[model samples]
Target chain A: MRIGKRSSKLMMNLYQRNKFKIRATTSNPRQGLLVATFLILVVIGADVFMDGAIRSRIRPMLVPVASFGRSAVAAVAGQDFWSSRQALLNENESLRERIEKMEAQNAGFEALRDDYEALQKMMAVTDEEGEKGLIAPIASSFRASPYGTFIIGAGFTKGVREGDIVLSEGGFVLGAVSEVNAKSSLVRMVFAPGQKTEVVSGSTGFTISGRGGGNASAEVPREAALAEGAPVRASIYEGRPIGIIGNIESASSSAYAEIHVVFPINLNTVRYVYIVPGNE
Target chain B: MSNMRLLLAILGIVFVFIAPPWLTAMCILALSLRWRAWEVLLIGACADILWFPGTFSYGIPVVTLFSLVVLIILEPLRNELLVDRRMI
Candidate 1:
C-alpha cells in the first residue's frame, strides 16, 4: 500500500511540473501552428544548405536496426508455417529441373563471354579498364518510401561512390548509387518517377521516362518498327541492356507509338546488388 | 493518457523505418490529436533520407508535408475533444 501511494505521488508531482509548459503550448492553437511551421521551415533550410550531410550521417545508423526488425518479423511469421512431405518432395523435384535449365543457360553465357573477350583482345581495345565490383545487401527497400528508392548496406567506406551502376544477377540494371554515407548508400532505380534516361530500343534511339513502380514508357515515331520484348539498352552504360519492352500501343490521335518497358528482375526479391565502380 | 501518447510517438518513429508508411502516418496523426508532437516532422525527414535519392530534383518529402497537414487539421478537434484537467 505504501509503495503504491509513493509511486502515485511521484507521478502526480512529475505531471504537475510539466502541466504548465504543456498547456502554454497547447491552449493557444495558433502558437502551436506557428511552432510547427517554423520547424518545417528549419528542416527545409537544413536540407538546402547541408547538401544531405545530416541525412547521410543519421540514416546509415538505422540500417542495421531496420534489417533486424525485418528479420524478426520474418522469423515470427515463419515459425507456425509448415509444408507437407508430398509438397516438399514436389518442390524439391521442381528445383532440380530448374537447376538443370540454369546450368544449360550458364554454359551458353560462358561461351558468349569467351567470344566477347577474344574479340576485345584481337581488336586491341583497352580504353575502358575493368574495375572490381562491391556486392552490397539491401538494407531498406523502396516499398517503405512514398517514392520508389532503396538503401544498400555499402557506402563510401566500402568504395561505393555516387553514380556507380547497381546491377542484379546476370548484369541486369537495377539502379545507380545516388547518396553515399559512411556505412550505407541510397540507390535510385531506373524506374523512379520523373527519372529520365537515354536508351536505345534495339537499334532505334529514344528517351524513356520513368513512371514509377518499376515501370517506364517511351514514345517512338509511328514509322519506327518496334515490337514487344525488344531490348532496351542504356546509352550511358555502353548499350548494356537495362529493360525490355513489355508492350506497344499505337496512339490513334498522335503520330507515335507508346512503348511500355519493365525491368527483367523483380525489385522486391533482389537481396544483393553488385556495385560496379568507375562507371560514373 | 499522456504516457500512451509518449509510447505512440516512440513507436511512430520506429515504424518509420521498420513498418509501412501508413502505420507510421497513423501513429503521427494519433499523437497530434493529443499533443504537439514535433517529432513527427523529424521522423518524416529521416524517412526521406533513408529511401529518397538525394539526386532526384522532382521528388518532395511527402511524409513531412502529410504530418504538417494532419497537425493543422487536428487542431480544432483537439480544442473541442480534450479537457483541461491540470491545475496551475
Candidate 2:
C-alpha cells in the first residue's frame, strides 16, 4: 500500500525527531554511568584473558618487578644470618680456648695418677707378671678392612714389634700388634673376635677367658665371687685393668652373671695410645 | 589513506596476530588518527581471532555483536573525551 506524499513527509519528520532524541539521551549522566561501568567490566575481562597470552612473551618485562620484591626480603634475612654467624664464631673460639686449658690440666693430672697406680701395684709384692716397666705413648691409628687396627707412635723405630702387647696410658691392656710395619703396627684389641685372655678381679685371683663382648657389658660366672664396682684386670704377660665390672648377672643355672663396664677408654675416640716395649 | 597510516594499520594487524597486546595501543592510536572506529576494531578482532581460534572463531559472532554495541556507546564519549583533551 502506498502512502500519499503528505503522509510520507510526516513519517520522515518523525524519524528525524527520534534520531535527534536518541543522540541527546546518549549524553545523560545515567547513560554515561552505564557506559562507563560496561567499559570497565569489558576491559577487566579482556585484560584477564589477554594477560595469559601476553605472559608467554611478557615474562622478561615482569622480572624486574618480582626480583625487586625478592631482593628486599633477602637483604633483610641476610643481615640477620651474618650477625648470627659472627656471634657463633666468637662463642666457638672462646669455648675452644677454655677446652685447651682444661685439656692441659687433665694431662698433668693423668701423669700423676699413672705414677700413683704404678707405685701401688709395685708395693703389692705378688710379683706374678714380672718386673714393671714404663709404658710409652701410641702415635697413630691403622684402618683396614676385615681387621680394624691402629698404629702407635713408637714402633720398631723404638723397638716395638709383632706379638708385643700394647697398653693404654692408664695401664689398661688394649691389644697386641698382630703385624708390624717399619714405623707403625696393627694392634688387634683383646676383645676382637677370635681373641681371648685370662682376667682376674681385684684380689680374687681366678683366671677367666676374655671372650669378646660388644659395646655392652660382659657376663661372668655369678657364683665365682665377682661383684659390682670391682676392677677387672687381664693376665697377659702383665696385669692391666682393661675393663671394670659394672653389674652381676642374676643367679640362674642358665645365665652367667653379666656386668656393664664402661670401656677403660673410648676406642673410637682415642687420639693417642701407648705401647710398653719391654725386654724382648 | 596516507602511506604512514596504512603502514601503521598493516603493522598493527601483523602484531595483533604475533602478539595481541600490540592491538590495544594501536587501536587507540588509529582512532586518534581519524580512522573510523569500526575499521580499526574490525581489523583488531580479525587479527586477534587468528591467534586464539578456539575462542574467537565460533565466539566471533558474539564478540562482534557485543563490540558493535560497545562501539556505538563508546564512539561519542571517546570523541568528547579526546576533544576535551585537545587531542582532536
Candidate 3:
C-alpha cells in the first residue's frame, strides 16, 4: 500500500511536469506520427547496414545462453524411462554394426587420400589449394525463421566466415554461411526459397540453374537426353554430385523440359555441419 | 493489470530466442492492446540482431517493421477509446 501510494504520487508529479507538452503532442497525432516515422527509418537504416558488426559482437554472449537452452531440452528428453531393455539392446547392436561399416569406409578413404595426394603432387597442386573445414554443432533450427536458415555454434574465432560452404557429415552440400559473429554463424540453406545455383547434368555437361528446397528445377531442352534419377553435379566443385534428377517434364508445344532435382540429405534433421572456410 | 502486462512483455523479449516467432509476435500484440509499449520496437531490433541475416539476403528487418506498423495503426485507436470512456 505504501509503495503504491508513493508510485501514484510520483506519477502525478511527472504528469504535472510534462502536462503541457504531453497534451500538445497527444492532441496533434500527426506530429507524433511524423517523429515516430523518422526515428523508425533511422533505426531501419542502421540495422540494414550495420547489423553484421552488431551481431558479431553480440553472438558470443548469446552462444552460452543458447547452449543452456539446448542442454535443458536435452536433459528433459533424456529422462524418458519407458523404453524396454530389449529395445535398448537392439539399438546398441545396430550402432555396433554401423560403427564397423564406418571403420571400413574410413580405411578406404585413407587409401584414396594417399592416391589423391600423389596425383596432386604430380600436377604440382599445393596443400593450400582448398579451404580447411571446421565442425560446429547447430545452436538453433529454422523453427523460428521464416527463411531457410539456422545458427551454428561456431564463428569467426573458429575460422567460420561469411560465404563459407556448409556441408553435411557425408560432405553433401547443405548451404553457405550468410552471417558470422564471434561465436556463432547463420547458414542459409541451399534449399531456401529463391536461392539458385549452377549445376551440370550427368555426363551431358548441360549447365542448368538449380533452385532451393529439397527439390530444385532446371530448364532443359526437349531434345536433351536427361532422365529421372540422373545425377546433378555442382559446377563450382567441378562435377561433385550434389543432387539427383527426380523428374523430367516436357510439354509437346514447348522446346524446354522442366527437370526437378532432389537433394540426397534430409536437411531438417542435421544437428551438426562442417564449415569449409572459403569464399562462396 | 499493468504489472502483468509488463511482465508478459519482458517474457516475450526473452522468448524471441527460445520460442517460435509467432509466439513472440503474439506477446507483442497483446502488450500493444493495453499500452503503446514502445519498447516492443527495441525488442524487435534485438530479435533482428540475434536471428536475422544481413540485408544481402532479406531486404528489411521484419519484426521491427511489424511492430512499427502496429504502433502507428493502434495509437489513434487507443486514444479515441480512452476519450470515449472518459466521456461515458
Candidate 4:
C-alpha cells in the first residue's frame, strides 16, 4: 500500500508540471503582442521626452552608452582599425601638402606683407599675437532637439565654454554654445529657420544676414551686392568668422538682404570640431 | 536565438541608426527577407528615434501609417512569392 501511494504521488506531480507548461505556452501568444506594443510605446515616449531638461540630466550617462555602441560596431567590422590606417595616411598626405602650400604661400606673403604692414602700422601699430587654443577631436555628432538646439560632444573638459566659438575647417564660425554640461555643450547653429546672423562677405565686402535655406538658396537682400560664389564669414561671437556664404538668392524683399552660407564642415558629417576660446 | 539572426538584427539596428537617407532604403530592402512588415517599420522607427530623437513626435504616426500601407500593398505581392517558394 505504501509503494502504491508513492507511485500515485509521482504521477500527480507529472500531471501538474504538464498543465503548467501548457498554460505558459498558451499565454505566450497574447503576451508577445502586448510586449511588442509596450516596446513601441516606450520608444516613442522616450523620443518625445528627450527635451533639454531630460537631456541635461541624462546625457552625461548617455555619452558612454553611445560611444560603446559606436566602438563595438567599429571593432566588429574592422572599421576602427581601418579608420586608424586611413587617418595615418591622411596625416602623412596633409603634412606633405602643408609643406608645399606653405612654401608657395610664403612667396606670395612676402610681396603682400610689404604694403599690408604699412597699412597695419598706420591703423594700430600694436603687435599682439593671437592666442592658440586646444584642438579637440569630436567624439560624436551633435544631438538635436525640437524646442532647443543641438549639443556637441566636447565641453569644459576640453576647455570649451558657453561663449566659445565652433569652427568649420575653412575658417568660418559655425555657432556659439547656448549651454554647456560637463562633457558636452549645446551649439545653436546660425542656420536654424528662425536664426538670423550678421555676416560680412570677405570676397564682396557686403554686410548681409544669413537667413538660412530650406531647399534652395537662402534669400538675400536684392541690393546686398553679393555674388553667388562669394565667400562669407560671420562674427556670431566677437572675433569669430562663421561659415562661407553659399548661393545667393534672387531677393524678393527690396528691403532685407539674405544669403545662404554653407557651413564649412558638412553639418551632417560632424564627427569632430575645433573650438576657439573667445577670450583667447 | 540563432547567431545568424542575432548578427543580422544587430546589423539591421546599426543601419537603422547611422545610415544616411540613401542607405536607409537599402537597409530596409535587405531586411525584407526575414522581417515581417510591422517588424521592419518598428526597426526603422527605432533607428530614427535613436538618431534624431526630434523625429519622434512626427515619426510614430508616420511610420505606423507607412508600415500599414506597406502591409496592405506589399503583403499581397509577398504572398505570391511565398506561394511560389512553397511550390518549388
Candidate 5:
C-alpha cells in the first residue's frame, strides 16, 4: 500500500515538471497539445529545417498504412453485415449508379466521336490519337486534403508526368497531375476550390470557378435561359461535360444569377482514375 | 494518459485517413479540449505529408497549420475554463 502511494506521488511529481502549469492539487504541469502539434511541427520542421529529408525518408513507410486504411474502408463498404434488407438496398443503389454512369459515358463518347470527326476533316491525324492512357489506383484519401488534391498509386515509373489529365471511370474529367514521385503522383482537381475553367452552358459561354468537393459555380446573365440538370461542357477537358448544373440562385437586385454545378459522379466511390497526356 | 484522452487520441488518428475533414477536425478539437493532445498534431502532419503535393504544387499544408493555430488559440482558453477541475 505504501509502495503504491509512493509510486503515485512519484508519477505526480514527473507530470508536475513540465513548462505549462496544470491545475493539479500538487501543481502538475500541462504537456500541451502534443499529438497533433508535435507531429505537425515535425513535418513542417522537416520541410523547412531539414529540407524535407525526414518526410521523404519516412513517407514510404507511411504509404502502406494509408493504403491499408483505404482497403479497410473498401472492405467495410463491401460487407453485407448479415442483413439481407441492407444488402438489397445496397445492390439497388449500385445498379442505379451503374445506369447513370453508363448513360453519362455514352454521352461523352458521342461527343468525343463528333469532335474526332471534325478534327479529322481539319488536319492530319497524330500517332497518339487512339492510344488509351494508363489507369492508376487512388492511393490516398480524397477527404484528406484541403487543397482538393489526391494521390494516385502510379507515378514516374509508370510514365505519369506533370500536367497529365486525369479522368474518371466513365471518362468524366477529374483533374490533372501536379506532382510526380517515384511510385505515386498527385492530382489537382479541375474543380479544385478557386480553380477556373471556361465552360459552355447551353449556347452561352462563361467561366466557372471550382467550389471544391466535385462542385463548381458560375454566374450568368439573368436573361439567359438555363435550367437545372443541364450539362456544362469545358473545352480544356476535350469538350467533355465537366459537371451538370445543380442549383440556381437569383436576387431581385442582382444582374447575374448564380448556378452551382455538380460533377455527376461521387468522388468517394471512385477507386481508380485514368491519366491522359496533356496537349502542349 | 487519461483514458478519455487516450480514446480521443486513437479516434483522432483513425479519423484522419477515413473520415471527412470536418469530422477529423472535430475529433481533434474535442481531443485538444480534454488533454494537451500533441498527438493530434502528428495525425494532422501525417495527413498533410501524405496528401499534400510536393513543392511544385499549389496546396498549403492546411491540416498542420490549422492545428497549430488551434492549439495556440485554445491553450489559454482551456486553462481558464478548466480552472475549477484543475483543483483536483
Candidate 6:
C-alpha cells in the first residue's frame, strides 16, 4: 500500500510540473510588456531624480566598447585591412587614386591660401600665431551621438581638457571638448542644436544658428556679398576658418538671404582631429 | 526567438555606438515590430547614456525618447498580427 502511494505522488508531481511549464510559456505578454514599460519609465525618472548620476557612472563604463566600435569603423572606412589578396589589391589601387586626387587638391589649395594671404595683406589684417595642440584619433562615430557630440581617444592623460577646440585637418573648427574621461573625451559640435556662433562671410557678420547634424544657418542682408563657397571665420580663432558657405537662399523681394554653412570635410570620413587645448 | 530576430536585436545595440542615428532608429523600429522587445528601450537608454554628457543641458535625450515612441507605436500591431494572436 505504501509503495502504491509513492508512485501516485510522483505522477501528480510530474503533471503539475508540465502544467507550470505550459503556463509560464503561454503567460500573458501584456503583463510583461506593462512591467517593462513601467520599469523603463522608472529608469528615466531615476535618471532625472538622481541628477544624472545614473548615466555618469554607466557611461564611463562603456568607454572600452565605444573605443572598440570606433576603431572598427575607422578601419572599415579606410579599407586598410583585408584577408583576401584581391580585396587588398583593390584597396591599394583605390588608395593610390585617392592620394593622387588629394595631392592635386592640396596644390590648388596652397595657391588659394597664397592668394588669400596677399588679399589679407592688402586689407592690412594682422597675422597672429594661432592656437596649437596635439592631434588625437577620433574614438567614436560622429553621427552616432544624438547630442551632436563625438568621442576622441585622447583625454586627460594626453593633455586634453574641457573646452578644447576640435578642428578638422583643414583647420576648420568642428567642435569643442565637453566631457573628458581618462582615455576618451566627448566633443560637442560647434553647430550642435540650440547653439549659435558669430561668423563672418566676406564683410558681412551674422550669427549662424546650429541646426545640428553638422550644419548651421544664418541670415544676412541680401546685399552682403555672400556667395556659395565663401569661407566663414570667427574672430575668436584669429584667422582660422569655421566653415564655408554652402547654399544661399534669396529672392528679389526678400530683404534677408539665408546662408547655410557646413564643414568642408564630411564628418564621417574624418579619422583624426587637431585639438587646441582649453584653459580649464 | 528566431535567429534573425535575435541577430537584429543584438545588432541594434551595437549600432547605437557606431552606426548612423537613422540606421539605429531603423534597427530599433524593426525589432519593435516583431516583439515588444524591451531591448529597444535599453538601446535607447544606451545612446543617451553614452553621448548625453550632462543633465538636461541638451534637452531631453532624443534617442531614448524616440525609442520609447517606437515601442509604444508598434505594440498594438504586434498583438493583432502575430500567428498565435498573443505571444508564445
DockQ for all candidate structures vs. native: 0.36, 0.01, 0.26, 0.10, 0.49, 0.51
| Best-first order by TM-score | 6, 5, 1, 3, 4, 2
Better of 1 and 3 by lDDT: 1
Kindly provide the TM-score of model 5 when superposed on the true structure, using C-alpha atoms: 0.72
Per-residue lDDT of model 2, residues A92-204, tens digit only? 77786897699678857975776567545433322433444333433322211112233344445666666676665455666776545444444666654333456678565
TM-score of chain A of each: 0.69, 0.45, 0.60, 0.49, 0.64, 0.65
Task: Candidate 6: give the clashing pairs.
Answer: none
Per-residue lDDT of A1-280 in model 4, one digit per residue for the tens? Answer: 9999999999999889777766653455335534655666665466467543443455555555455554455445532345566665776777868976895777578536744653343223122213444344343333222211345677777777766766544445555565566886666555543455555664344444333321112554567577655555555466455555556545454665555666555554443445667643
Spell out the clash pairs found in candidate 4.
A172-A242, A173-A241, A173-A242, A219-A258, A220-A258, A221-A257, A221-A258, A232-A245, A234-A242, A246-A261
Which regions of candidate 1 deviate over 4 angstroms?
A1-40, A73-131, A251-254, B1-11, B19-36, B55-59, B73-88
Instruction: Answer with 2 or 6, whichever has the higher lDDT.
Output: 6
Question: Clashes in model 2: which pairs?
Answer: A138-A273, A139-A152, A139-A153, A142-A150, A249-A257, A249-A258
Cα deviation of A238, candidate 1, in Å? 3.4
Best by lDDT: 6
Ranking by DockQ: 6, 5, 1, 3, 4, 2
Candidate ordering by lDDT (highest first): 6, 1, 5, 3, 4, 2
Determine the TM-score of chain B of model 1: 0.80
Stretches off by above 4 angstroms in model 6 are A1-28, A80-132, A235-240, A278-280, B86-88
Better of 2 and 4 by TM-score: 4
Q: For candidate 4, what is the DockQ-based docking class? A: incorrect
Model 3 docking category: acceptable
Model 6 C-alpha lDDT per residue in residues B1-88, reported as the tens digit of each score: 6686689878988988887777888888888888767778888888888888656765797888888898888767776785344243
The predictions' CA RMSDs to the true structure, in order, are: 9.7, 32.6, 10.5, 12.6, 9.3, 8.7
lDDT of 1 by residue, A180-245 (tens): 888888888888777899998856899989877678998899788777888788977656678889
Give i-RMS (Å) per prediction: 3.9, 29.3, 4.7, 7.6, 3.5, 2.8
**Residue by residue across A71-114, what tens digits does model 5's lDDT show?**
77765664544568765677677786997699678767865775
Residue A177 alpha-carbon offset, candidate 1, angstroms: 0.9
- Cα lDDT, all candidates: 0.72, 0.48, 0.66, 0.50, 0.72, 0.77
